[model samples]
Target: MKNIRNFCIIAHIDHGKSTLADRLLEYTKTIKITEGQMLDDMDLERERGITIKSHAIQMEYTYNGEKYILNLIDTPGHVDFSYEVSRSIAACEGALLVVDASQGVQAQTISNLYMALEHDLEIIPVMNKCDMDSAMPDEVEDEIIDLLGCKREDIIRASGKTGMGVEDILKAVVERIPCPTGDENAPLQALIFDSVFNSFRGIIAYFKVENGVIRTGDHVKFFNTGKEYDADEVGVLKMDMVPRKELRTGDVGYIISGIKSSREVKVGDTITHVDRPCAEAIAGFEEVKPMVFAGLYPIEADDYENLRASLEKLQLNDASLTFQPESSLALGFGFRCGFLGLLHMEIIQERLDREFDMSVITTVPNVSYMVYDKQGGVQEVHNPGGMPDPTLIDRIEEPYIDASIITTTDYIGPIMTLCLGKRGELVRQDYISGNRVELHYKMPLGEIVIDFYDKLKSISKGYASFDYHQAGFRPSKLVKLDILLNGESVDALSTLTHFDNAYDLGRKMCEKLKELIPRQQFEIAIQAAIGSKIIARETIKAVRKDVTAKCYGGDVSRKRKLLEKQKRGKKRMKQIGTVEVPQKAFLAVLKLD
Candidate 1:
């Protein structure tokens, strides 16, 4: 029990967290180096060079003839998967705060550090990528010490790529990070930080035993769901699955029952022995809530079942993902899916396309809105089409986020201008280093949901990094801007925008749509409206035919008759012709500058 050490690697994207994990595995001789970076099991992760999911492995090492059980969990660095990092932190007692020696501190680095602090975990600062030519170890060490208030000597300098100082990092973990302590005699209590579904074995729950013991054949129950099942198998995580007879207190392992459904065992749920159940559930085990919502429709309506199956299988691994059956008048039958952020949504869409072989059309992303009706009722709206009538709504509230952006001082003006345009309130700003600045703002989540990060990167020339978390809802003068094509409202093109910017946004959207929408036989009127009031409109002139071109040496009256007939035909077509809006037209509004 004294030799057990549980920790997780927390770092920003491309900070060498996964590489460091590989080096640690190699140093511990847990798995042969010939196997390569085995911890990143997902092919998508390997291709993208980003850890999309949190992974855990149990390794054993020997120092001074003393064997230590070192359990390390690797967390995703993107802001979208911060919840995974939080859950990983909850399962461990310490964290290896990995920072790039070249990049110094980044937006996600600060965001992840705060989360580790919130969990009260002991942080072991490690500077990685020291082999690079641009490495600035001394400056990065100062940044870490300043941010964490740790001693200079406490920071570990290591190169994950060249395997330099890897042994020292392992030794520091065993010495500085405390071992897990729990009572084996107490009731069985394990935290299900992650879970996945299996066809043959059913649900496999990965957990850290907080107290007591769990073994194969024991009857275990989920505290939140109150579902009981016999533990058919138990094991600790290695490079692969290895069965164990029992998992005692302070141990990280997996439990498998006959339960086939993934919904039965939820992440953040507590598992305990049915006979010796704990008096109360463990604290701080709230389920993750998605922050972004988007509609996904199958290109072929018949593939809806396949899409549904894919989502269900994906949900087994992604507990933060939520979805329900929904239909859009323009998009047909589809599922309204909820995600942590844009990256999460993108990853899910990619997986659906690659793994499931399904092509899907995604609507514009939106954040949940709280609508207060004049009848003293409140409703949550995830889609712009679901918003109540303007007359019945007293006020609307939208989700706000505390956004932190870190960049070079040169881009301050552009960053500030972009933030203000997004309705961001400048809360604070400070210099993290001689040349780096950290700008804090409170901005609507909706504004940030679409192209804000892209624009920020463009303005800063890719120097700025961004991180944000929900800051709850705030009252805002928001109105739904609906796009009308030839006097018909297109639900998929509707969006919620602040009243102040509605007119300008509507005008821009109309212009963009006009450019993307092809000209038809009749004139097409592209209009943007708030309720019944049209705020902006653009006209696409009808395609005309030269009926008088065939007239050869005709009298003036004959030419005039042919020209008049053509004009009348065009007027008739304009009165009755319906515009054929292509899919690109619907997506064009999403790319409005």
Candidate 2:
């Protein structure tokens, strides 16, 4: 048990957390059971090079005649999934903090490091990407000593991409990371970090045995909710894409106790003994909430049932997601869905396209808001469709975000100017480890709810990285604008905007919508309005010339030919009447740049 070590590989986005895990898997011979194998079992995880889900693996190795078991957890680097990262940190006794030798420390790295420290876990600093030409190990080491307050010799340098210094990093984990310290004789208790589904094997819950022995056939209970179940089987984390057998205390593993669905297995929930459970559950646990939302539906109304069923299946695996039936005057029927961030929204869209083989139309994304009415009524609105009457709104409050940008000083002026244009207030600036500087800004969630990251990257020539966190809500005058085409409000073109910029935004957004919409047989007048007042207008010219299928008098069949041509024209006219706007066109306006 003393030889067992549990640690998570922590880093910023694109800082090589997954790549380092791959190298560690090879070094520890975890994938040796198969030939030409990939360490990450999930296809999506490998393609993105970022860990979308936290997964643990068990591997054994021998050094100087002593065997050690390494339980490694790979965590997501992006800020949207910070909840998942916190769970991973709690499950481990220590962390391998991976910082890019070239890029040095970043905003997300600081965020994740603070989380690790809050867990009171031992930290083993590791510098990755040392093989790159831009690698600056000396400066990064100094930053670790300066910012993290670590000794000069504490940093372990390596490259997870090329498998350099990986074996040495593993050795450091065994030497520096402490073994599991909880009492093994106490009642069975484990903290659930992640869970997955098995068609034939039911639900598999991955957890850390924080206290006591966890054996097969022991009855378990969730401490807070008092929900009970039987632990039919206990097992260690394996890379086989299947369940293995009996994991003991001082080990991070999985258990399949007849949990038929992942719904019962919530992350951060405590699994404890049924008769003699732990006295208290872990504190400071909060459920993950979806921040932004949009309506998603299939074009064909017949696919409505299929779409709903598909979303339900996906939600069974991810409880953090929320969705419900939403009907539109234009779309007829659809579902409104909520997501954590832009990346989460994109991932869900891709999955719907690939897994369900369905065509979906998603509306422009919008953040949730708290609206106060003149009658002293308060309501929370997640979608513009649910917004209250404009006349009744007394005050509108929107979310604010604390944004940090890491960029070279050469592009500071341009980036600052861009932020100002987006209504961002500069908070502070400081010099980071590498010649890169960190600029802090307090910006409205609406400003960055669009293309802030894209503009930052473009201005900084892809060298700038941006990350943001919720900084609470502030009172503001906000309004929703409805774009109309030929006196009919297009459900797809409805969006939120500030009262100050509402007119300008409406004009630009309407123009972009018109550019995306094709010309019709009848001229379409695109207009933006607040309530009954029109603010801006653009005209989409009618098609001057259309397809003409003419036929000459052809003896007896001439009349029949004319009838066939008339039928073809009728079909074309019907197709033109039901012109459903595409999702890409609605999303284009949000791109701004």
Candidate 3:
């Protein structure tokens, strides 16, 4: 254990975390470099050019004529996948804080840095992309010094593309980061930081052993689930799972117990010997809090059970996703799913389609709210349809967030305008270094959950980085806006909006739906209403059959009779016709400007 080092790579999105990881793997000769971003093996990850999952691999390096075992966990840098970074941090003793040479310290860089510090992990700062034309290593070096308080020489300037300074990074990992420390004689105590489902192998759990030894064929139990199973196999992860006789203290490896169900395993659970268990489960395991909520209904009602099964298996891989059974008046049986943010929600939908072959309809996304009744009873509402009658409610409070935006000084005006338009209150502002400024705002989570980040990037010319956390709720003038099709309320199309935005939001919803919902045989009236009052309305003209066409060149009275008969027929058809809201109509709300 004294010759082992466990560390992870941390940085902002697209800041070369995976590229740097590739260079490290190549330098260690762990595997042949056949493709770029070998760590991001998923099709979606490569297609989107983002890392959706954290990958861990073991490598052996020689330094000063001594062989050292190194385990590197490459982490995702996007804010939506921050939970993955936290889990990776829990399994390692050190982190490589990579900052792009051009785009110094970003919002996610600082946020992830704080997470590492909270875990007391040794941090080694590395300036990547040093070979780029716009590389500003010295300026970024100063920025890193200001943020981390580390000396200039402590930072290693490297280029993942050219493999420049890659050797120095490995040397720093050995010299600066401390070795994994624990007692091997103690009872078995291993933390299951991550796990994945395998079709033939059942479920494979990857863990880090903190104490004692785990041998193949040993009986083990997960503390969280309190379930026991036989360890069918145990081994170290090196690109491929390498079978081992036993895994001792300070070792990262995978265990296969022939578990058949995904529900049997939980991430962050403790693994202990069934005969000689540890004192207690590992403490300080953080639960993920979902920030945005939306309805996910299978396109076919019979697919409900299949959808649930897929979600359960997907949750095994992604612990951040949460869902509960729910039924919508328009969409039939479905689940009300909670996500981290807009991007997280989109990724979940795409994964369901690509990974599970499940077709689903996602309703308008919103944040949870607190509703207090006249009797002083408080209830939390995730869907607008579950809200109590407004007459019996005392007040409604919506979720808010403390938003931080890091950008150059030039885009401050447009950024402020965008925030103010969303009813954001300025909390404070400070200068980080040079022309870079950090602005903090207290904004409603509902306001920014949709397209605020996209707008921020657009206005800042892709230079602004944003991050936020939920703040406590405060009472506000809120009303539930219900969308009615042909005068019948559609529960799946309703949403809760602040009173000041109710009319405008209602009108926008009406206008957007008009363009997405296909026109029916009879005229369809789309109305947005709050209780008994209609706030906005739109009409989709029917494909008129023109009963008068046959009466052309006929007597005036005959044409009038034909038109009146057609009008009566239309009125009768409107009463019995039901509107089918296409999936595009449900998704159009997300793109509302």
Candidate 4:
């Protein structure tokens, strides 16, 4: 077996984690023809520098004429996959922590570095973006030593974009990061970090060998679930693609364990020989949980089946994701989907929009709430639509989020002021990096439901970054304000809120909804209310001029098309007699500004 060096790259969002991986692939000939004629699958990865998923690749290089196999794992930088980050760190013995020299260290960087330390991995600090005009390598190195508590000589100055200092960085990996240590004679075992599906190849899993060697046609079993499968082929992820091959201990590789479905091979599951299984799997694996949830429904009700199939296919590769069919008394049918966080939710929405070509209306996300009934029975309610009747709800509790903000010292005042305005309680503030502070707060999830991040970025001029985790539920005065259109409660107009801001919140939401909803042939009454009391009301005046101007034979098709579109659009609108509430009205309420 070749001497293997297994490591992972971690950083905060937009810190050039994926860019560094691309540079490594190009330099190591994993993407070019100098080493081997192959093109890096840099289409999506290059366009979006964020590694939305965890992936690994292998390259062969001769350092001092001693050929070494470098197995590099690229991980997601967003806080949404904090759980996945833990698993990826566990799969490697060391990590190359990339920090933006221009921006310095971020909250997510500290968070991920702590996770790496918890796994007891050797951290090799690297300052990226050295090619930028504003980059400060010396300052970044000082911050790394001060904040990360690393030695002065441990940091590497490198720019992944210009191919500067990359060789030295790789050499440092070979010398400073120790080779994988495990019982090579032990039973074959590897931990699945991520997996995906192929049209002809069935399920493909990317894993890191923790012990022994795995060969093709070996009978293997998943340690946690006790599920067995025959190892169909061994492979490695190269150029953002999977190529089949044999892999050994200390090497990160792919195993198509004759498991036809990706659901069978889950992230963090250990693969071991069925006959000679390891005594125990490596520690630090944790279950992935969804943090944010929203209701997703097709603009057209007939696409429910297609929606279900799309969700099933999405889940095939993402076992941590959860979704279920849900229905509203007024909206008919929909699905409540769970996500790791806001970025995850955005990616899913973008995928659905780009891949499925479906028009979707997504409701505002809500964290699970606890309800204490008049009988003193506490029930967890994930969906606001499913919350018990307010009359029966003796006490309502809302979810609390532990939020951290990384920003320049100048914006600390505005950011913290905004946080306090949102009913956020200050926890602590620490200097994360030179001139950058980490503001920790416990805030109501409801406050951040809309454009809190956007406002933060705006105030900080896009310099601030935010990361948050659900702390738990806290008892609070909560109510579900149901918006009505012509005396009927619109199913999509429900918002879980505190009683204090119900009036103004409802007013602002209804105003935005009114603006979003297009004018109709008939007038629509948009009213926001608490129970039977109307707090805010707006009228969507009927169309004063909407008919086509020309109806000649040449313009007949165009005229008919316009008329047909209007009729179909009107049909999609929920009409209560003369009142017409367009579907976009429900959507606009979800969009704060």
What ranking emerges by lDDT with the best candidate at the front? 3, 1, 2, 4
Identify the leading candidate in terms of lDDT: 3
Q: Which number leads on TM-score?
A: 3
lDDT of 3 at 63: 98
lDDT (Cα, tens digit) per residue for candidate 1, span 1-593: 89999999999898999989999998888888775457777788988889998999988999889999999999999888988888898899999999999989899988898988887788999999999999999999989988999999998889988999899898999998888888889888899898877778877999999999898999989998999999999999997889999998899999888887666877888999888899887787567889899999998899999899889888978888999999988778999999998889989989898878988888888999999999899999999999987889999999999999999999999899999989999999999977999999999999988788889989998779999877899999998999898888988888888999899989998988888888887788899999999989999987877778877895889999988888888888777876766766655666777
Model 2: per-residue Cα lDDT at residue 98: 91
lDDT of 2 at 465: 76
Task: Identify the superior model by TM-score, candidate 1 or candidate 4.
Answer: 1
Worst 10 residues of 4 by lDDT: 35-44
Q: lDDT values of the candidates? A: 0.89, 0.80, 0.93, 0.78
Q: What is the lDDT of residue 457 in candidate 2?
A: 75
TM-score of model 2 (CA atoms): 0.90
Q: List the residue pairs that clash in candidate 3.
A: none
Name the candidate, 2 or 3, with the larger TM-score value.
3
Better-scoring candidate (lDDT), 1 or 2: 1
lDDT for each residue of candidate 2 in 2-96, tens digit (9 for 90 to 100): 98999998888888877788788888877753432254555676677666677788878787789999988888887667777887888888999
The number of clashing residue pairs in model 4 is 0
TM-score of 3: 0.99
